[model samples]
Target: MLDALGWGAVAAASLLVGAVLALLRTWRAGLIGGVLAFGAGALISSVSFELAQEGLRLGGPLPVAIGIAVGALAFFFANRAVDRIGGRKGGGAGGLPLAVGALLDGIPEQAVLGIGLASGEGVSVALLVAIFVSNLPESIGSASDMRANGKGRGVVLGLWAAVAVVCALATLGGYALASVAGGQVRAGIDAFAAGALLVMLIDSMVPEAHDKAGNRAGLVTVIGFAVAAALSNLT
Candidate 1:
């Protein structure tokens, strides 16, 4: 359990790191976009190779499929609702929504980290790397937006710090829940995380990266995917 907490905290710490970077520097949009594209690619590899494969192995196709569908639909609607409420801009005026979306994205991934710990597979280095890398761009972008909107540095940092803590707790929660969950339940949870991640990449990360980085984003994304995939295979 302590191990789970430690790893969880470590994974989430990137958010604070990214937030600090954003607060400290005015990042070029192209650079931020490249990072976002790379992170998105890593996440794509994680969902495909880590979550989906494991889900298929433990619970077969049907349950995992259902979980994926439900998770995708849930995130889609929730994201839309948040957008309507003020998240439409993705930054600046949409800081709250962006933060909320980051929470939504981070929670499940962190939970999956805890789940891996409980599964007796030890830590999944690839998943941790993927989550950490993916989180950086998000927090950076969101923090930059919040700053642009006239938010105090303290407020922005505090918000991401709080999110990191919550995500760490989520990892602990998933570890605890794993004690009572069977294979099918665990598989469903994994699939759910994957589905939510996929939707997030498609709906937000990819588009934003492309908008900012143009064609270069594609090559960077491929590089990210290859590197992550290699890591997954090696570990």
Candidate 2:
């Protein structure tokens, strides 16, 4: 209801602000890296607690294990596509593919957050904050890639708006369903989100860090996970 709308607005606004900040020439790279780190933390926290616990609650041990495996596979293929496109020879037009994929990925994620937030105010707020914060890197990265591809500002904004609409619809639907079915249903949705996020973290985020920072990147990656885990426990 109103709560869901507020959370959605918060998520979208945070992402938009992050995108603007990320496009600034002087601070873009640093901000992107920092946001990526936060994204890592978010994926780790969501997977470890929300998703895993939800699986166990709804479908016992087997479903949880299966969900993890399936999630890993999903992440693997999605990144593979991104890598393939990214590796193509000069002027590969990164924006379209990324925008499309992001829209697809974002739908379920928003839904998970919407449902999770419905459970308890504190839990939902914390989850929403993590998701909102994590999305900054992605929004910024999208804007930068579009700019590099020579897309006009209007095009970039249009693409962003389109994806945002998809997310809003998906989240609204997920929230409605979760609200009807209550706890067990919410857990299932959380598991799906957790698994998907985990896949994205391992396949994309870690590799990007390694490419950027070389050997020492692993240290940063670990630090990111630790910070997120600690914060999740506090919640």
**Candidate 2 TM-score, C-alpha based:** 0.74
For residues 1-235, what per-residue lDDT tens digits would candidate 1 score against the true structure? 9999999899999988989999998888898789878877877887888778988998899878987887788778877776675545544344454465567657766777787789897886766776777788778877876787788999999999999999898899889887787778777877887777788788777887898899999999988888788877774
Least well predicted 10-residue stretch by lDDT in candidate 2? 93-102
Name every residue pair that clashes in candidate 2. Answer: none
Each prediction's TM-score versus the true structure: 0.89, 0.74
Error of 2 at 168 (Å): 3.0
lDDT for each candidate structure: 0.80, 0.60
Model number with the top lDDT: 1
At residue 33, what lDDT does model 1 achieve? 80
Writing each residue's lDDT as its tens digit, candidate 2 over 168-190 gives: 66666766766575555555555
On the 0 to 100 scale, the lDDT of residue 12 in model 1 is 91
